[model samples]
Target: MNITFPHLGNTYIAAKVLFEGLGVDYTIPPLSSKKTLEIGCLYSPDDVCLPFKIMIGNYVESIQRGADTVLITGSCGPCRFGEYCELQKKILLSLDKDIKFIVIDEPAKIGIREFLNRLSMVAKDSKLSKAKKIKALSMAVKTINLIDNIEKECRFFAGFEKNKGEFARLLKTVKLEAIEAKGAEKTLKVLEEHYEKLKKIEIDNFKNPIKIGIIGEIYTIIDPLSNMYIEDILMNLGVSTRRTLYPSWWVKNTVLSGLKINFSKIYKESKEYLGLCIGGHARECIGEAILNYKHGFDGLIQIFPVGCMPEIVSKAILPDIERRYGIPILSLVVDEMTGEAGYYTRVEAFLDLIEGRKKLCI
Candidate 1:
């Protein structure tokens, strides 16, 4: 089966590496864009959250490009994300698109045997031996972690860079070039060279730029197109930003959480506010806000698409966190109709507020 999946930041890079290393055919849908969103909205119900719509767009685009199977992860939480696969399948079928869906869900929900059965659909397509298949999976994880690290480094160093735009330029260049590498091994090599390069980027030691922690729905925070590249915007404004959620973190949490052995720190921090995993990343979002505040971030920006139930709950609880910690927090809700100008205005205003607060403290 020719496989395709939704784009989640640097996830496409790792997925490409994994599928190719397995000797399976796959199609990388063009990056998420206005056209993708438009297609998604056209098919999705009006009330579904933005992510579902954008994902639909990705699948449609991939289908047109000759993908017959759509590979997606599933969650059995109270969050709407769990429902995405079922709805997407129906939508595709309604549109007369004959697509196969392989949803990789938790073993508990789908049963361990069923989980393996679902995974085998893709795994069995590979010509490689079982040992090599396992190796390929490991390489894909490493690739994701390395790319996430590079992005984190770039965002944190952007504020202190000796030359304006240097960090951003290097980050953009690395991502673009890494994806073009011939194979998983070459991609890893490219990332390693750039990881060292990122360390050596010139930074002014004394510049204490505004630092903000991004906390919100996992998909919105990680995917640039979903949030209108908010992290890039923060970097351009010379602000250092940190986000705790990444594909690597998600993978780890998903695998181990079923064993009740995941997110010790997040659980500890969020206990006072949201102790339960009420679906989505609401608990994590609440925990992250407090964690960033304790770590002395200037402020926090909480972003999620409109109609996200878990984030809506977190939004209600965040003001209390802001008051308790005395840190400013801005909640930005986005959807297909979000205007770029208004979004940028609010973002800039939030930055200004943080800067003003910093000046007052000084």
Candidate 2:
């Protein structure tokens, strides 16, 4: 049976490796694009969060390419992500798309037990084969996850080195090697190779690496509709950004702690890092930015859904943060109508103002 997973950057990359190792074939969804968004926006409610639109588009396009199944890793939270599988299924069925969805629920802390179950589902037809597959794939997954983490960590500080593309290239190579290799030692070897190669580069052109702290709803941060790929936008505009949240942290800290109502978790890496706000996931945006500012970020950007209630609440107090920190800030609120050109235009303008000050100090 052919299987497929959505194009969620590293998630599917890791899944493709893990699943493929089990003797199952899987295809990743196509890279997300404008036409995908157009299709998604056509079927979605105008006011729903942007992630829903982008993911719907991902599914719509994926099924057209003979993709028989869609993979969904489950979530339990106040965030709308918890219902993505059910909602996406409803949308696909309403459109009469004959796609099948394979929803994979998160494994509990039983560690190896949870992994064993996942392995059995996708690979190993017989009991004996399953046992062997589990041992091999588990080792590979640990290696893959490690390489992925290293690459992600490298992204954090890549700005400190010149030719950020060089680091990006090495990261990709290391990740692919980890996925295809048989042993954890192979993973370690690839990582060491990349590290050695990077040390050779002079990297003297490393920019000032102004720190820009980003905070917002999970959708806006990851989903292009909400932020128009703001992270990339920041990097191109020469702003080295620090984002407080990631899926690992989301799963490890927020999800595992039992879904608390009314936003109680004090996110360690977020801009606010801890605090409250109202509307549009603004509380998170505001809190993350405040913490980031105190931590010495040169600037902060709060991204959120156009109508996100909590973010709307946070925006009200953003001026107070600006006043308190004496640092530059640019908040980008997004919806379907927000265009990429317009977003970058604003970012360029912000970068000009900030970079101008940097030059003045010299």
Candidate 3:
């Protein structure tokens, strides 16, 4: 089967490594863009969350390019993500797309046997042996972790770079070039070279620039198009930024969650505000805001799609966190109708507010 999946930040990189390592024929959906969102909106129900619409667009685009199977991770939730696969399947069928879907749920939720059965379906078409397949999975995880580290380094150092925009430029170039590499080993090598390049980029360590932490619903914060590339804007504005959630973090967390293990600092900091997993990354959002403040970040920016239930709850609690911790926060809600001018204006004002606070501190 020629398989496809939705874009979630650098996940396409790991997925490419996995599929190629398995020797399976696969298609990477075109990167999410305005046209992709428009196509999704045209076919999706008006009230569905933004991620669903974007994913629908990805599937439609992939199908047109000859993909017949879609792979998606499943969630059991008080949030709406759990219902997406069922709804999306019907939506595609109505459009006469007729694509097969494989939803990978947690083994604990769907049972280990069922999870493996679904996994085998993907590996079944591969020419690789069982041992090789296992090795490929391990490689993919390492690749994802490396990419995330590269991103974290880029975003955090953009403000301190001696050559403006060097980190941002290198980051874009690395991702584009890595995708063209023909095998997992080459891809890993490409990333390693890029990581080294990032480390060697000149930076002014003494420069004190605005430092902001981004926290919000997982999909919107991770996907550039969905959130209007907020992190890119912050980088271009010479703001150092940090985000606690990334695809690698999600992967690591999911694996350890069954053992009731979590990031202890996050759990402790957010305990006073939100004590339970309200589905989505709401708990992470609250905990990260506190964590970043403790780390001395000047401010925080929380972005989520309009009508995102989990983030809506986090947004309500954020003002109190800000008051208690003395950290300023700006919350941006985006959807198909989000206007660039208004969004940028608010970000600029937030920066000004933080700068003013800095001056007062001095």
Runs off by more than 4 Å, candidate 2: 96-98, 104-154, 162-165, 168-200, 203-207, 223-226, 254-287, 359-362
Q: Model 3 — which ten-residue stretch has the worst lDDT?
A: 258-267
- Enumerate residue pairs that collide in model 1: none
Instruction: Give the CA lDDT, 0 to 100, for residue 63 in model 3.
Output: 91
Local accuracy by lDDT, each model = 0.91, 0.63, 0.92
List, residue by residue over 190-268, the lDDT tens digit for candidate 2: 6567666656754555356767777777656755445776765555544567775654444444344444443433444
Candidate 1 differs from the real structure by a C-alpha RMSD in angstroms, to one decimal, of 1.1
Q: TM-score of model 2 relative to the true fold?
A: 0.75
**TM-score of candidate 1 to 2 decimals:** 0.98
lDDT of 1: 0.91
Task: Pull out the clashing pairs in model 3.
Answer: none
Runs of candidate 3 with Cα error greater than 4 angstroms are: none
Better of 2 and 3 by lDDT: 3
lDDT of each residue in 250-360, candidate 1, tens digit only: 988877887867646887999999878799999999989988988989999999999999999999999999888899999999999999999999999988888888998
Local accuracy of candidate 3 as per-residue lDDT tens digits, 115-198: 999999998898878999999999999999999999999999999999998999999999998899989999999999999998
